[model samples]
Target chain A: MEKGLIAIAAALAVMTGMVTGIGEASVARQAVESIGKNPDAADKIRSMAILGAAISETCAIYGMLVAFLIIFVLGA
Target chain B: MRAVFELQGTVFYIIAVCLAILVFLIILNMKLKKFDPLDEPKGLVLMAMMGVNFIENMLKKDTNKEMTEKLGPYLAFLFIYIFIANISGLFGLTPPTSNYSVTLTLAAITCIMIEYYSIKYNGVKSYVKKLFEPLAPFVVINIISKVGTLLSLSLRLFGNIIAGSILMSVVYQLLARVSALIPVIGKFNFVGVIVCSVLHMYFDLFAGAMQTYLFGTLTVAFISNELPEEAKGK
Candidate 1:
């Protein structure tokens, strides 16, 4: 019963990724739109987009990290 | 080994591995000392030139000449050490960066440098003013964000390596299950060898290099950001 509860909790904790997915899509869309407008600045825009995306994904990573910690470390 | 030397295994392994790589790099660099880089270098000479050029170009682009000269060697050492540590997982040893002790030390040094240099370049008054910003309430957020940088930098590297190692173990377990359908080969992990090779390529080599690039680039970018705009040649 405790194992099941922990498992369910871990699953629910990762629901934060839903927001992350939407955020990632919007970031990509804007990056692509900007690149299209300024062809010459594509390299700079690409690097900026990657750095921005990586930052935006932090919350999702944190969520997964917490879930894993809860399931393995706390549940134990 | 432990009985003879009374040594802790992981600590000893980390030291020996790092020293071995350092020695190898030194020997390679020594061998290339006589080669002129402009004469269409090849082989080991070309590799050394590529590494030096990468660091020089990266530092030149990011910082002023004085700052570049001051910090270039430090950043280059950081880049090479981390690149090796990340890929060291391929040797079936614990990558030092995956250890929180190692990562925390690196991040703490970076954080201290960021704070120190920012204050030094901008002066205490301006640094405090920058923190307070257009509103007083933002100071709390500013402080939190500073801590955030340290946590994110360290955690990102640690979490990535640990997660990859965990997933690779899972892959091994799955491989064992699949191979169990066959004969005694299951005990020997026949399927694991094939699948793990591809997994290791993705996880260790490709991801390792990419993460090293991200870490190095972010270090330069963050340091540059901390400098005054005029100082940064903006």
Candidate 2:
């Protein structure tokens, strides 16, 4: 039962990426639209878009870290 | 033909490699300074300049204008150090970043810098004052945010690089086993090499560069965020 709980928790942890994926996709979509409208500023827009995406990526990273800690660090 | 000393631990190997890289970089800098005015810096010097400029531009985006020049080299070195640690896997060595302890140590340093600047430049009175401003109970939330930053930054680098290395190994084992079906090339690791090279390119090179950029960028952002703009003016 303890192992089952750990597995379920790990799955939920990985699911955090779903939200991040949607968030990043929306950011990319808007960045593409902005770049299309103003091609001259594409460089700046691209950098900003990447940084924004990375910030969102942090959530998924945290989730993975939690799963790792539960399975490995906690001796579960 | 003889060994003078035996290095037994991973930590020692990491120190040796990092020191070698630093020494090589110091020599490169010495060479860079003697360049003729008529010619552009080529090879290592040009790459070094580009790296510095990249970090400089990221920093210049901050509202605190003074930090761009002051913190530029420190953050750029952070990028280079982490980049090498991440890519060590490509050379058949364990990437230093694959270990949690190294990443945690780097994060600890970042946390120290963040707190030091937070209390030092912000002034202890204002630091305490601002925590209670808007509400007295917000101090706990503010402290949690600080711990959250340290955890997230270290773990992101650790998780991404280790996942890459693990997947690359799996790819290698699978390819080697599958290659045995070919009688002529059964004894060779060639298929494993060719297949795993493609995987390693993405896992190590691309991921390594991105992790380095993220780690350095986050460090700069954290430090500058803690520093008060008005206090930084002098």
- Give candidate 1 misplaced runs (Cα > 4 Å): B1-10
Model 1 TM: 0.88
Residue B170's lDDT within candidate 1 is: 95
Question: DockQ for the candidate 1 complex?
Answer: 0.45
Instruction: Count steric clashes of candidate 1.
Output: 0
Model 2, A1-76: lDDT tens digits are 8888878878887889899899999999999999999999997788678778877888998889777877775545
Q: Write the per-residue lDDT of candidate 2 for residues B1-234, one digit (tens) a residue.
A: 889987546676588669868887888878888877579778888887788878777777653556677677678678878888888887788888888888988999888878887897788898889777678888889778778888888888899988998888888888888888889968687899988888888999999998898788678767777777665444
- lDDT tens per residue, model 1, B1-234: 457665445576579568977897888878688776567788887787788788877777767888777777777777777778888878888777777677777878888888988998999999999999879999999999999888777777777777777798899899988998897656788899898999999887887787777777777778888988788642
Q: What is the TM-score (0 to 1) of chain A in model 1?
A: 0.92
Candidate 1: residue pairs that collide:
none
